[model samples]
Target: MDYIQMRQKRFLIAAWAFMECLLFGGLLYGWGSLMYVFKHEGIYAELCNNNDQAALSAMTNSSSSVTDVTLTNSSEETKLSDSNFKGCPEQDSKFTLCFTIASALVCASSAVLGQINFMFGTRVTRLISMIIFVGGSLMLAFVSKEIPWLIFPGLSLLAAGGLPLLVTNTQVSNLFGKGSSSIVGLLCGGFDMSSAVQMVVKIAYESGISRQHSYYFLTALHSLVLVSTFIFLPKDFILNEEAMSTNIEVAGDVNVTTELPIELKERGDVVNEKTGGLKENNYEKKELPTLMSCVRQPLYIMHVFWLCILQLRFYYIIGTLNPYLNRVLNKDDKMVSHFTNICFYIMMGGLMSSFLTGVVYDWQKRCFASSRSSLRQNLMPAVLPLTIVSFLAVLLSALVLVPVQSLLYLIFIILTLFRSFLYSMAAAFLSAMFPSEYFGLLYGIMILCGGVFGFVQFALFTWAETYVEAPRHTDIFLLCLVLVSFLHPLYQWYRCSRAEKELTQ
Candidate 1:
């Protein structure tokens, strides 16, 4: 690819990343704040045509009667408050379930969309996702209790609209070669910073902006994404010849070839015999591994398992934070909002970590080349250190939960930053190990596993909260869970180190 094309690809990647950031902000992180509005703002009352008042009153009476009976029987004090009854009956549970189910649907659909991208190319896939997202937002904005089922479809479509996230990472890795790590970091950082988007929306809502206006704002943001996708994304989804050639290097007098799929070879792009470089069409052809073949690889399985574990904890933390703050820590609404606003700043730590990881990764590659050593042998130097830091951070975060209420803000900051750092490191690892053609499919599968594990994690936490009764005691069990989860990465690191030693000997 020429300079102009390279610049264009970079610009498109940035646009896509920004689009994903907005989508995530409005749909993923924004849901919690939206639910708060539904509860406190009379939005649900309007949706239910003011019938919610009668229902909430009846529920409150029933709750008081139950509390009276319990107190009389056990000789203990029980308190009930009007504030607790502020929201529509079951709104919290309804919204939480909607968010969880929507996330799973997004993962499953993204997996399918990955295959579609391979078949139809970037433009079609992006257009489909954009339409779904916009349509879903409109549905959400106008939905009422009469059409309660709309919540499922609306949230699901909005979540699925994140297909560009999968595509952009693959494209950046393909265009930038070894230097893609920092760029990928920037992309993922944009994603993590989506909490800021939600914060902005939340601020707007709290400052007397109507819910309908908030929905309109979201729709406008997604419209920008649609326009950017149409204008910036390339028509032909071909890998850059220069980036591909740079990826092919000589180490220890042996050529390291990054294979493309057989389909690209048939497109008239050919390798030059004399220069050992790609010629014609400014594209490089490489043979890619099929999805089935990828599933059969043990290391691939290990990588997916590690990712699932990471996400299990991540989703659980994010999902439970509001209740944990309000119920367990006794934080007020303003405090909760304040903490949420700071989340993106904490996530910025992950952005820095990811960029540093990329710089180190590229530097290691240069070192291998200069020393005439095998690049393949050093393909994953970043994994070990990243895993160690991630494991320690998780351990500390879990331990701090015992005193979490005392230092709630600090603990969350540390936890969010390190968890995000781990996520970026994992993405970089996959990009380095796999062919770009298969990255999307494989990433989708990883996300699918995460969704499955996340649901299981959510169920476990719900069970604990319902059956255990003591939040402090539950922290002990959660700590144990975090510890057990580390075993997967530790075992994988051991296996990889052993393999590297064997290769050296």
Candidate 2:
């Protein structure tokens, strides 16, 4: 790609990243604000009360006091009869149900989107995701109390919009080559900045905008994103036969004989001996590894396992951050807002970490290239250090939770910053390790596994809360989980170092 084309690709990556930010903001993080609107406007209460009345009417004794429900304007607090005031539990349950269903759908949609990307291509998958996102936002805006169930499907569509983010990451990796970690980091930074979207929505709500209007605004924004994606993203950027052929040659040549472990040379396994140069005829009959074959690799399995665990912990922490802060600080509204602002700053920290990590990744890659070293030499310098630092940060953050609340908060922020950087770095590393054609499928599988683990952990947490007194310390449990998650990276590092030592001998 020339200068203009490279610039265009970068611009396209930025646009896609922005679109991903919007999808996360409007669908995932925006839920809490939207649910607050439903409660404040008496919509959720009314829905619960209707269900109660229907249940009562079905029984022979229908003597429950009827509670009057009315919609309150944006400026007024919603009021219900005393009999209905206790319906908060039921309303909360209903909201949880919708949220859970939407989350499950998002996971399912991610898997489906991966298949679509593999079978059809990135263009079709992204266009479909964009349309679904807009449609979902419109549904949320127009849904009435008569069909409260519409919220479930609307949220599902919104969640599906997130799938295109993975597609864009793959595209960036493919276009710039696997070593373009800085660019991927820039894109991931845009993703971390999604918290700004939530902040904007919260401000709008505080300014007295109704939920419907907020959703309408999101719909319009997504529509613009859709059009921009269609115009800017190249249709031929996805992996094709030609691209795969070229990449095969590149992958074949990365293993310089000098860098191979001596044991490998003794076994006559080095590539430079027999295949000195990449020729078209050499790969003409070679078949790319299938997705199943990749999955069966021990290293890949370890990667997926640790990635899922990290994602599960991160998702849980993010989902419960507000409640966790409230429990820790016992703050009033103004103070709570201040703490939330601090969280936003932490997000900015994450953004910077991502960008910096990317720059370092590219730098390390350049160093390896200059030294005529193998890509394996770049792994420890470019990726393993970040993983180790992030894991330690998480462990320390959990350990410090028993100290002063303010101190704990600071440590947590540091943890979040590095954790965010680690996520992007891992994604980029995996993208480089795998072939472009199977990247979507593998990435989607990782996401699906993460979602499943998150759901399982959530269910376990709920069970503990419901059935146990003095339940296990969640922080301690998370710390242990983080510790266990580091084992895979340690294993990889050990193998790499051991191989390098043998090669040097």
Candidate 3:
């Protein structure tokens, strides 16, 4: 708790914050945006192989020629939409299953590899992983023929790179002491900001560029992330990186507590009263954090599950942006055009405001958790209101999905940002529930679920797109609203129950 120690903690936290800035630049955003297209297009390409336009055009047609008139036109569009395989029924579920199964397998691979990476320590492994990541992502630029073949090596490299993202926060916690929430807030904020940034950058590149060349731009941006990782991550970021130990040091004039306030201190003494803490262990410990124990804790489980759900929709909405914008706005223009600028701005503004809320939210948790008996207990109740507001916003936004004028369209723009901001609060909720070690694992698993959610979501969107021929934005909005409304209370129930259980324990 001395000044040197505090200084070390700040230095460490700063390293993690730097790492978080990579955000969607490295592991996440592109995959997030591409989830649906990858599955759908991947399947369509695999089935038809080198004949994309023909297969897609035929499948999309209201009617086909004599050779393609295999199925009669007795069913509603909705029925056919739900079932797109009648024309070439065999290729339908194959894509859906493969995408889901592939992602799940990769997710599992990440979970296992993460444990291996930890054994080698974060700094070396994270950098090595990055080296491999760039090599894999760069291969994507040359993939023209045999797209299915690209799926294997391409996805392997992608998945390998993906695992480090989950571990980055833990690395941050290692760099920065958890005394200030700013580090964590910045990490989460960086993610939203980068996502917004990526959208803008991606749009700008689309001016005269082909869609295939879109990813080429991100390679440069990701290269910047790699450079930043090395520069920002301190030499002492590794627990064993430093030969000399750093003691605690306060960075500013402000008073910071290295111990609980006397009134809030645990009332009783324990057997570990004279126990010495481990020198190398900078992160907090879970009493018994086997996956089952973690999962069995309903509050913790709900925190993870709710985060995954909110993230799933968040990913879903973002992934389907190209089509969503097309459905709700002008189809002639590309997504990167000025027409989509407003949506990007709204997302940027909302995310920044949401970032500022973390300080107040965490302070509130400090107030509620005044007792020091369990100093590291979770404060996920703070997230309940965010869930409620977000779910309601989504419902409200859905109700106004079919904006008739530029004004309504503008409202939808802001509403989408509001929805993003509201749901994004769940990340804060999640960080409070799990400490650094668990943070990466939790993030990886949550995102893995999001991958599957993304697929299901794509399937649903495809069904809806096929059904609502003329475009029913209102119906789609209402559908999202109803689902959110149902899920919100269940999350609330789970969170409150968890808070109560933690208090009782």
TM-score of 3: 0.63
The TM-scores of all predictions, comma-separated, are 0.77, 0.76, 0.63
User: Which number leads on TM-score?
Assistant: 1
User: Model 2: per-residue lDDT, tens digit, 1-505?
Assistant: 4334645566565656655653453245445445544543555666455454433333223244546534458844444542223333456556655665666567667777888888887677778877887878778777666767778888778777855664554465445554467666766666666645555655665577766788788777666555545655555354423344343434443442222222222233334323332223344222455678677766567777877666656655554454444455652334445566566656655567767767777776665553322435544554454465446546654644563566756665665565556567666666655656676777777767766666755553454345333123665666677767777767766766665666577
Model 1: per-residue Cα lDDT over 262-298, one tens digit each: 2232233456543445566665433345777666666
TM-score leaderboard ranking: 1, 2, 3
Q: Give RMSD to native, each candidate.
A: 7.8, 7.7, 9.3
Tens digits of per-residue lDDT for model 3 on 255-277? 32222211122222222111211
> lDDT per prediction?
0.58, 0.58, 0.45
Q: Against the hidden true structure, what lDDT does model 3 obtain?
A: 0.45
Which candidate order results from sorting by lDDT in descending order?
Answer: 1, 2, 3
lDDT of 2 at 9: 68
The parts of candidate 2 lying over 4 Å away from their true place are 1-39, 42-101, 142-148, 177-179, 238-286, 331-334, 366-375, 381-386, 389-393, 396-400, 403-405, 408-412, 467-472
lDDT of 2 at 485: 71
